[model samples]
Target chain A: MLLILPIIVPMLTAALLLLVRHRGVQRWMAFLGSMTHLGCGIALFRLVQSEGIQVLQSGSWKAPFGIVLVADTLTTLLVIAVGVVGAATTAFGFAGVDPRRESGGYHSLFMVLLMGVSGAFLTGDLFNLYVWFEVMLVASFVLMALHRTKEQVRAAFTYVTLNLLASAILLTALGLLYGQSGTLNMADLSRQWSTAGPPPLHLPLALLFLTAFGIKAALFPWFFWLPASYHTPPAAISAIFAGLLTKVGVYSMIRVFTLLFQRVSPGIYTLILVLSAVTMVVGVTCALTQRDFRRVLSFNLVGHIGYTTLGLGLLSPVALAGSLLYVLHHIVAITNLYLVGGIFLRVRRTTDFASLGSLYRTHPYVALLSLVPIFALAGVPPLSGFIAKIVLVQASFAQGVYWAGGIALFVGLLSVLSMARLWDESFWKDAPDGVDKASPTWKQLLPIGALTLLSLGISVGAEPLLDMTSRVAGDLLEPSAYVRAVLDGDG
Target chain B: MELLFALTAGVLYASGLYLMLRRRLAQLIIGLGLLTNGTNILIFTSGGLTRTNAPVLAADALETTEPFADPVPQALILTAIVIGFGVLAFSLVLAHQVHRSSGTDDVGDRQ
Candidate 1:
């Protein structure tokens, strides 16, 4: 029952909001629904930590026959992250978006987007996962184009086109897997795949899955559409994308690679390691040169995803735990920065760093708030980001992959330099003559302040979070518990 | 029969790729449609052919039966078909919107 509410509450709220006529009522509905989701997510996390694994077989059907929803430790953590970020982004959306410009459709779309993301995190059936991906994609398309500017339209086109193609690839892979295995339930598929197939088919299926996930996660060569589109959307929508959308792809990649396809070809890991290196270098290099604040942040966003994938490719328990911790850290840190960037844009009325400066003079609290996460993102000591990177680097060293660790450390330095540049250029420099004056209201500070406080709390409470990540990583590596629960559930 | 279906699927995929490489919007839509159909055929062929056998569970059917058409792939293909249709409709509308906003049907012409 706990496993189902995170998805159900938002979906029902979205439907209800659609029927209502007033915009204010819809906003309240969205806020209430998102808060309930967060509460449910925390409750589910506690339940899963106490129990082993929570499974909800939909439509009263059995595991191999009906769709199943599994909430294990890993899934629980992801759900909590999704719920936290979802609530924060929703609050940001309410505070940041202009109701006159959005009117009735914004609240409903926000609810649906939350539903799609939560559904993706929770569903256990392969085909059902695809359905949720489309649900998420459709909502994202509508949200990305919400403002309806020329650039928004063009960027939306690119985003929708690339994602639809990726979805097509996912469908093709699903078709092949179902035809080959005769089961779409993940547990049954894992069991049958180990003993039933010839060696030749595994490589193709693995590649197909990798390609689909690679595109979605914004890996090196497959990540062009991300930077092209992510910067043009509203900052609130971008915050959600940064926080949840790409992480869903990472979650799928981790889930499939670790759970289903265990005997992945040896060379593929090497390829992934190299790609991670290139992604980190390229993303930060691009960030170093960008003039727009959001674009620079967008590049850094892609760079951090590479760090997580690097940990996954290393395939050590330590590395995997680090990856999980990094996922948690990056989700919080990036969303906070984007929210701060939103505040900056709201005040400055432009996204370019060159045209704006000296925000410290006008909004010293926002400036100080922004620095905390920026320093954390730079992997400063005694912060969550530093702890995540230390674990990741140590894990790579344990596996004797010194080059991968070295590159990660070097990239960490570059991330700091790029962030420092952003701080200096956007907040510290003196405002030029004839620049537009800022008029910031207190409501705008509420969401930014909330995110800032949350990051500080995570940084201070890093030990418990690290322990939680280790436990989750252990569960992910040995998914026998997940498989057993799915197979043994009531039909 | 299997050979014929495989050849047709291959032909559709090839033609779809060719059209997708073109610059025009209408051609891209056509390409996507053809590609989806080709994928459907590919999935159908991967399951192997069974003549005069169905997956329907009759009242007295045994658990183990010879030459039964695999129902799982067909179920997967059904879901894929609906999803493909949704994607197609959404993309078509998006293309229309793009055309209206940009006043061009050629993807290459946009800056």
Candidate 2:
């Protein structure tokens, strides 16, 4: 029951919010719902830590036959992270979302999106993962279209079409997997993978799954849809998308790469390593070229996915820990940066940096707030991103992949340059002519304040997060406990 | 029978891929539908041809004997079809909204 509550709480919240028409009541309800979700997340995390892995089978059906919800250390940690982002974004959405959009199921859809994200993180069946992806995409499409502007609609076309293709590809791959393996449960497949070597069509199936997840995670050559669409939505939605949606893809990739494709092929790892380097260079360079604040963040989001994949590609326990840590830091920093863009939009009345300036003069507090996440994102000293980068670089060096380590450091440098460009344009320069000079209200500052505190907290308290993520990484490299806890749930 | 299903699925996939490459969003929707159906058929065919009893056990027996159908693939296909339908419906509506707002179905910065 505890294992399933994280998915259920947000769903019930969405259902309840859908029925309530009053915005005040709705906002209060959303707050209640998200806070309740965070409670569940923390409780579930501690429960998993104390009791070890937990598996909840649907309707008392036996494992390998039932739709099971598995909560391992990695999964429960992801749920906690999702809950953190969900709560932060919902609170921020209160002020960041447009008034008109808010009245029309904004909170409801946000709750549903969180449910989709958490579901994707928690599901134990491949087909169920596909369903959660669909659920997420449908809500994301509607959210992307909520603006209903001409440009937004155009962006939605690319977003919807590409994600639909990715989903179809994943579904087809899953079908093939089921046909070949005669089981959909991940634990069952892991068992088969161990007892028998790579099953029939294993390489092709792995490649297909890689392609599908790559698109979702915004890996190189398949990430165009993200930059094209992620910026058009309101900042609150963009923040959540930054925080969870792509991370879902990373989570699944990690899960599948570790469990289903356990050989850790040097060929695939090299492929992924090269792609990570390319993605970093391309993503940061593109970010440098973009003038719009959200667009730059979106492109950067794509590039950061490389670090996580590189961690997985390294296929070492230490590297996996680095990747997991990088994912957590990147999610918080990226989400907070987008929210800061919202505060900027509220002040400047435009997304273009050419027309927006002097935010430091207008609101020094907000400017300082933005710096925390922006510098954090660039991997500055004493911050979460910096620690994560050091871990990855050390792991690469330990593995004698000096070029990968060098590339990680180089990417960090480029990331700093791009971040500096934004700082100079948006904060250091004089105000452009005729820009709006509105200040953010307390309502708007509330969520930003919370997130800023989180950013600082992550940097200050990196030790616990590091220890926990590294432990989860250890679990990821070993699968018997995962398989037994899940399949043996009949006990 | 397997060859026929495989061939038809191939044709559908070819046409779907073709339509997806076109510039128009409506055609893209059709392509998406075709792709989903093609994949569904592929899954069904890949499950292998079975003309045996269902996996359900007899009233007096604990489990079915050998030579039963692979029920998992059938169940998976059913779920896929349902999910594919939902995605199709949503994408169709989204494409319509794109046309309504952007005034052209060509998916680019043409708006």
Q: Mind giving the per-residue lDDT tens digits that candidate 2 earns over A315-430?
A: 88889998998998888888888888887778777778887777788778888888888888888998888999999999999999999999999999989999888887888789
DockQ of 2: 0.74
> What is candidate 1's CAPRI-style docking category based on DockQ?
medium
Spell out the clash pairs found in candidate 2.
none
Off by over 4 Å in 2: A264-266, B58-62, B109-111
**Alpha-carbon RMSD, each predicted model:** 2.1, 1.6
The candidate scoring highest on TM-score is 2
CAPRI-style class, candidate 2:
medium
Give the i-RMS of model 1 in Å.
1.6
DockQ of each: 0.59, 0.74
